[model samples]
Target chain A: MSDTPMEAAPFAEKAPDAPVRVLSEGLASWLLVSPLAILLAIFLVIPISVIVTVSFWGYNEWDFYPDFTFENYEYLLTSAVTFDTYVKTFSYVLMAWAFTAAIGFAVAYFLAFHVRSTVWQVALFLVCTVPFWTSNIIRMISWIPFLGRNGLANEVLLQAGLIETPLEFLLFSDFAVVLAFVHLYTLFMVVPIFNSMMRIDRSLIEAARDNGASPFQILTNVILPLSKPGLMIGSIFVVTLVMGDFITVRFMSGSQSASVGRIIQNEIALLQYPAAAASAVVLLITVLIMIAVMLRLVDIRKEL
Target chain B: MDRTETKGVSRRALLKGTAAVGAAAVGSGVIGAPMIWAQNIKDVTLRQFGTGVSNLNEVAEKVKEDLGFTLQMTALDSDSVTQRAATQPKSFDIADIEYWICKKVWGAGNLQAMDVSRIENYDKIVGIFKSGKLTPESTIAQGTAPHSVGFVPEPGARAFADEQTNWMTLIPTIYNADTLGIRPDLIGRPINNWSELLNPEFKGKASILDISAIGIMDMAMVCESMGEIQYGDKGNMTQEEIDKTIAIFIEAKRAGQFRAFWKSFDESVNLMASGEVVIQSMWSPAITAVKSKGIPCVYQPLEEGYRSWGGGLGLSANLSGLELDAAYEYINWYLSGWVGGFLMRQGYYSAVPETSKLFMSENEWGYWFEGKEATEVITNPQGSPMAQVGEVRDGGSFEERMGRVACWNAVMDENKYMVRKWNEFIAA
Candidate 1:
């Protein structure tokens, strides 16, 4: 009752003016937020909702119809290929994550800690980002000459007498897929990790050192905990990107390997939208589960 | 409020407003046909969605100058064209697509049955193309029946379409026989059969196309040669047949018989040019691409025969009135001798050879159509010298090449299963 009277004092003093002022403030905020909200709803939410809705639909060669059927899901569930593809996709995701996290963390750590000058730090960061200025397809194809049987790597190795013949598996193999993924996605890991490491209080490290903690000990105890959010975010990016990537796998692996995304792409190519949607929904759920696990590990929301 | 109203308009704001208004006017001018019609109706632009096989910007400009209507063509790959046809039917007035896509588009109700009377050059379509099947099986009792798979023929047209057919699905445009492109320097032997794709000697040095519909047919030819399976109609495979064919590919893939599975025309070219792959299923244009690089790439004519695919123009169901009329003019112009000659120069054969002949010089006709040795340098689609003097077109004359079409690239009834299996093979 007392709070109510206190809240109403302004209303009582300036009756209509106060309510109108409050209403206009709320309206202005709404106007400010609307553009982003509308864009999100239109582009992101609507497409996802459509995919979810279509996942339950039935389709033939000619048309996709609005009939609730679990047949698409059932077929996916029963298929051995789906299981194999998911396993392969997950393996790629795991392998890409390990390499990206290690490389990204190392690069980020060096820039954040060692590079004292802000200008040098920025220049170094840009150097890391320079590859991104070009189209990714061109960058991916550039690896062909570097890694091909008669490529620079093989030529160098042959000159060194490391092996008699050129390596066949270097170009169109699982190794190439991981190499391309690391090349493309390590930057995704680096930027966030760098940002997180930048935010780490230097005093915390100094204090840990004062407490007789080694540099390794400081990293494990203080820096690691502080950088959890960035790690989680980077992991999410790498995992999701690797899982959803069809092009890199298609090109780098020379279409010798299949990911879940590739199968969905194949279905879309065949105009099997419902099947593609179902596969997409399953992929989305799988990604969500992975994100949930990462979220559990760090609680990125709380950290941010 | 009175002071605000009295204030002079800022030059920046005035200029911005003027620019916005001008842009809106221009945008509306492009979209609104009636606005153009009110001033001048003769210059209607018809929207065309052409497949990558016939990406002729020069021809489109020529058509605009010749015909009153401007031809705005958007080139798309086959899959994108099919997807667009299915989902966005009203996007194009006409789509130039493959014969396989005709049935799918027709079934989806995206394409309209073309009125033969609208096409001025309809009769000029060749007799063999009108028959639909370039190579109908010899035995009617057991082998697949010879049938025209292009636009459903108008009634009284020969064995190509159903005898009583009245609907025309696609107006035949361009076609060619595709074969395996190999590096002669690496292989150092005469390759004559499709079974060479699986030959252990070339293991880890051969690639196949990544397309399921077309790639599966290529593999089916290999299976036939190896005596693994004999398809009644290789174009259309049953579930068991698809499984059998895919199994052969999977087995070969497991044994490292393939260096890669190529997707685009350029990828095939790159694979051959870079010496990453020794032999692979390649398009005719890809062969030209490799050969242009001064590579000793040969588009080998296998004993099993060439895998052929044909494309033609079809009117969109949503098109009508002036747009439809413009579309007809564009189609007629495409069949006109100049465009055919343009396509012929590019390595694609037009439906009407006579029209192409009229546009071509005697040397072009001799080299391209009659399969005689070139007396002079023969140019590719891009007008680059593809063949020097005395160089003969591979597989001899056009008749010799197209006549032995082993199979047409088909979207089989088991397409879904085949796609799934193909993905499995890729993943495996």
Candidate 2:
């Protein structure tokens, strides 16, 4: 194969030394990137391509076929249930993101500004991350005993005469699902925000104080603006995680709820691979658009 | 938290180390075919793949000692087992799966038919399974179409070509009925029918399983009991039946009649023990678990009869020659004596009950099989004290329970329709 492009020939002929150096640099860059490129192709690109190809295939009750058909996509697009399920899934994502961001921001702020000692800050930040030590499934299940009808929350309330009747909507409702999601995913929000908050110039806060700005005003004008990149990154994480979740919703809502991911899971369970693949593709596109919007709102590159 | 991060880092490092070693091995041709081929062919490690039901490590150890071949058992969930069997048959040598998976897997040509002549204990399986019909009355009465005969003979088998097929689809293993579990203290009355799961009095206290296939079947039974609809066959519902059943489910769910829909056995137990649900669909083990916590719960015997299921061992289509012979030996060993007795102690019935008797003592047989009051304290499969001297099995005897099986678990023709509707119901 020809090593040089046709348009570059004039430059290469004028400076043969430059062409040799350029070729060597190009080879080094290719060698450096080949391992990561190969990994990405194998793990991400190949699997996504397979899913997309499978989404176009046909399937009957017994098995999937290689025939190209739009029936899977048609069914998904036309169904009323599909729209409703997506709306419900997005509601979960929105709620989870809001709660996680609020909780994560508060915790990160406390560690960065309120805690004076470095050792104390590190130790306390680790404490906020204590739940991450357990598996997601275990963490979700632990809530059952704490929030069930005869669980600690209910019994304590009843004993103290806080209410006339025991609350029946604690364990297996929308409340429990949202609770579990917040508990499991807030860590994603905390780490990025904490990293951003730690990098903020302490002198900026001192300057704001000298200018007679209130704590809330300083937070609103300076700290919030500086932390937008971290907040955007955290939001992307929470949104994608909540949107793609199936197990937490399945277990916590006691199967009373369905996310888009859960719908895909249902199709796979029924041996309907084409339909599942189509649903998965739809979710992937939706998540990508959301992330694109979030990235557009904040230029993380400048901040980093 | 720091410990977890360090542990994660170490795990990643271990994975990278493994990848490096693998790359080196490939570069040096150390894992080449000649090296693999040089080993004794009969010394092959038979890969036993199935759900946790069949992945008893103790049994695998016993098989290895007796047969002088490694039996490597890989446990997966139901969906994953079917997925692997359907897409990658050669990854496993023998498959121990439920009977319902046979039709789908066999139709895909992923499973091979067992030669009845080779299985030494083949003749000893209970007559009910071999015949597929326990009695004339036991046949499904709702369906006009000829019901699917349970023991399916494979293509090109001698029995299928020459005479009535003795070539079985699955060598029968353990089986049991699943029904409603109820908290006795809360109900304040005897609940005897499947309709009680939907009783208005129990609204906000009842739950069902989350699995679409099994959950729909349980709901179908509830519908049939309530005179809401009639089914041609509950196991294989038509599209219209599935739609109607799920619509009813949606209406009920919207009305706030259910507390939750459980996905796992432990979740079901937790629901019962914590008194979140007073009534729900449950497995036998879950019922045992609730009671073990000193909570008053029962695996209620419903008047509509029980939804039953069975599983067994099948050879993969890829295995042949020495590996095939070894698979046959393992299947025979599963039904021989010890494994059956082991499973029977866990409240499941073995195909050859008589063979299981060879391994059990008189007191154990009297308690587990005969359903007599325990003359002495009886231990469960885990050797925990499950019952005192006067306790009895919930449905009476093994024969009484198995004989009352109304329908076997099936992969319905309308599974796609059911799944779609089930999702709608959950969303609604």
Candidate 3:
């Protein structure tokens, strides 16, 4: 202990006087972080501030002007069509998140617990991630061939004599949108959960088994409780992604379904910038509340 | 430590401060270097839609050589182009929009009206361009009055009449006739009319281009020929006439006559090539694609005339002073013989008839440029005329086509309702 204290003394003694050291350290830290701080100021803070400011202004038909009014916000709150878009968006996100999370957890569990070799585990995970490397537009378009009226799925079923007519419900419907959401975002959930699962203690599971605990008991009492943080993290990723997605819903749902993101897109297209900004602000607040609720549930601070 | 070391530190600090200042000066110099070089140049950007046909690169080079001006060109889809025109008016100096879309954007007061007097080539414009009710005063307003002047019409270079080719409001730039493109190998027979699309035998094998106006027009033509409605008038179509047309489409869709709806030109071509669709409503370029592949396909002429649309260039509302003067010069050059000849070779008929005649043979001009016959044979790239045989009528004399103009820049104000109704029809 004395040797250890002596070893640290030279470096400590060479350090500047207390107040000078503190000042120098603070200056060095500021120098290192200044680029990032500038980037955040320009890209994130400034844009968001502008959006908030614009939300309160009135549209002059020809241009956006700096007339302070609550007309945009009032329009959002009063319009039934706009309010319904929010409700529809929330429900779609919830369904999509739940579907992705359920399947993702299962896939992650199989990869972590059942796979015997590291090579096979890595290979399987890579297979799951393969579709993600392609452009999202290409992936969405690939669905057209398989889901068209005279598509491969229908052809297969018809050949097997399973059905006489083509299934119209297969494509350009709510089912297709949800299916695409799950397909695209499941890996986003799985990767985080699998990482957390890899960090779980093997010895604890072995000890539970040695004490004659059943497989179900071990899973319910030991594994699931420990995996809550990962589950919450996965849910956060899926929920936020599904909530903000407009392209997938638009392409898959054809014209029947409307999401909050799509409404924002429509407003922007129509040059209704203030209304779009107000809707965006509302969506941001809603997503923040959701994240806070999720944080409370999982105590993500502990995991961090 | 040593008192000597402590005394030396202040000297080192002075050197480090100088180095830091030098490095920052160099860093900022590197960042600011390109801006200094770019300061002397002024950028004039134009955005248009339709790929492989617009010849934007060639046009840009021509402008640079002739007018001592540089042009930055971007290509986008029709919808995206119109959306950008409405949203970011300052981002583009000129835009090429379809005739129907021109009405919507023009109505929105996003486009500037042209000064016909300044456009030197304005007088040489074919009768179709001159005859329309779209005057400079009507199109060019100071504020939110939808008046736009820079129009370059294409393929369907006819006037808007109650019955035939009523697109007079647009300055026709590039126009292609809409015809039935059929795969001879698959159909094993020649297709001559619109009735074949609804034939029960071709169920799930037939397709139509999913543009609202074109599709609706085709349906109306079919219904008119079938005696489902009176044949002569289309512009003043009653609600009952429109419903009858809608019903034909709905019935066809219910019978699985359509495999899928295509949102792009490429998608439609791909579907045709794969044998997924044997017959479809298509433009000339699509026929060119099938012929290029050596697949036996033909653009069959129906008994009724082809439904067609054209795109024209429009000015922005914000142009003024020197920019406006430059805009007039550009528009004049665009209407000159060179652009007209260029467009003609790309399968588009130009508004400047003399310019078109300069490049095409008298016979070819008679068939296409003059619309002398209802259907005429025109040579493909390989020098063999892709057999385009049908009812040949002079695409009525330029005056007749322009004079009887029926519709100008027709855009449904209730597009949301239209989209919803269209979706319901598709779903059903």
Candidate 4:
């Protein structure tokens, strides 16, 4: 340890301060983030490690034992059901993502620009969240009465002479599953996109207006590119959620559809923990790959 | 609603009794050994968990009244119950579960063999639980029948024995002859056979359970009734049998044969009540729930006979000494009439039907058991009238229904394959 700061300066290389001071600064940063690092290690890493270990273990009808075998993964990778389920799951993710992005962007754009006052924007944003305050299950189940064969939508359509017979496809179909995903998760997209929109410099828009650019040109050229971070974040949220969801598909599609998450859940229900663990590992990788790709597309670090 | 009232009253009574016990323990502390004598009953709290159908809050309250011990009850779905009972042995003291589950759970060694000599109504259990027969003339059903897994050779036995023994795997409690429930007001016809579940007439308005074990059984019922496949044993399907069953259902599913598949009691009720589905697999309580809403539903007796199931209570292997003693006492109280009669009102049979009869009235016994037309309005345990005058129990008397049981719900040896196939059907 050099006692004199001036004497250490010649050998410091790129260091602007004393070596001890630099070490203390790094130590302080580590101290600041250690709690989160420790938490992730304990809650996230340990459980995932156990799951990975269990995935390779053998299982009988009753219990899982510590015998390493790749049978769980082998079956999951080889089976036609697994392939079909992944295809269906990807379709749900695509549909849910597309709809949520479009609707959420429109809503967020309106709130940020057209609302005119921050107070009213906040109040209206709160109004959008009132439906979320009840429950996801209740919201999903409530749709049953509204979209059933003789439900309100059909009855209204009948009275309006919109169609001859009730629409059977409204309630328990792929249409319903996607509808529910949008209903539950559009707010996830809205809040983030709205945040990014609010943070945008107003002078840029004013300058764009001063120019002879069309409103469509201003939206596409100025706003959309700046909102890429928010879009990426919202896409991550929607994609990961849809990928990991089983309940929404189970309830909304009336058990006619299958997803990777549902496969894990079914295995867990049957007490085939090793098989579930295997399926869950596959699902985790799929979701992570999706999130990684989304992250690569846009650096969302600036948005936060 | 009235059941909740009784539960509240009993809870207050229990609090008062606990206070008395505490005061007495303090008073006797001058010459005490931690009041072990007084500590035996009230201090003992047994955690019980099982399927929602049998692990009722009412039963827990009644145990507090009769046994002077706290019975903490948690009710989960059958799959969850099996998962917890097998994996988390220390989490519960007793498991109130189905007999079919016993076959799987027993192998896990989480539950201990119960001493049958301690059961007050051991001899009074129906023959279906003993020799797998309702009568000498009755044939044993082709599933994991109660008798096959009800007993063990010794207290530490790993295997199930068909013979009557001093050690039992579970103390039988509730059972019923299950059949498809139909909307009499909607279907507009007498639905009499199991094959109608696949009939093209109700193509997109039919459903079955999403639970794989029971769903496969129902599929067998449909497949057998349609002469699609002749299974040697529908309960335990071979790989070829499993493949054929899955293929048939997968085709039906692709052709829009199902409106929806249900797992929970409420889902079945909602599917039927909303007319999203007109014919589906349903439970007794679901039919009652529908009828209570002024919807017409019937537990129709098909020409092919009924699919049946039984539920019982078993002690966790971790239970011993005073807690185990209290569990036995609680089980004895359960068999001694009150719970039997309570469950019977909901269209289930008590293990000791004779004792249950003591708790029920002549009219109730006649209506629910004898299948006679109810002379007066018959109410459920909650005291709301469910049946009007001259209405008979669906599927008729105990003998007529239970005697005709085609098979019991079971887990096949090819359960993993069956589950995969079931998932495939859902995907299709």
By TM-score, who's the top model here? 4
Kindly report which residue stretches of model 2 are placed more than 4 angstroms away from their true locations once superposed. A1-39, A115-123, A198-213, B1-44, B65-68, B135-164
Better of 2 and 4 by lDDT: 4
lDDT of candidate 4 vs native?
Answer: 0.89
| lDDT winner, 1 or 4 | 4
Against the native chain B, what TM-score does each candidate's chain B reach?
0.85, 0.84, 0.70, 0.92
Task: Output the worst ten-in-a-row residue range by lDDT, candidate 1 chain B.
Answer: B138-147
Per model, kept true contacts as a fraction are: 0.71, 0.67, 0.02, 0.82
What are the per-residue Cα lDDT tens digits for candidate 4 across A1-304? 3455687666786765654555575676798799999999999999999999999999887788998899999999999999999999999999999999999999999999999987999999999899988999999888889999999999999999999999999988999999999999999999889989988898999899999778999999999998888888888899999999999999999988998888888999888899999999998998888888888888788655
In terms of lDDT, the best-performing candidate is 4
True lDDT of residue B310, candidate 4: 96
lDDT of 3 by residue, B24-115 (tens): 34433422321111221233434433334564688777665544446667787565666777677878777777766665555455566554
lDDT of 3: 0.64
Residue B121, model 2: lDDT of 69
Each prediction's DockQ against the real complex? 0.53, 0.43, 0.07, 0.70
Better of 1 and 2 by lDDT: 1
Candidate order by lDDT, highest to lowest?
4, 1, 2, 3
- Give the per-residue Cα lDDT of candidate 2 at B180: 88
Model 4, stretches more than 4 Å misplaced? A1-23, A209-211, A302-304, B1-39
Off-target runs (Cα >4 Å) in candidate 1 are: A1-40, B1-41, B118-120, B133-147, B151-161, B164-166
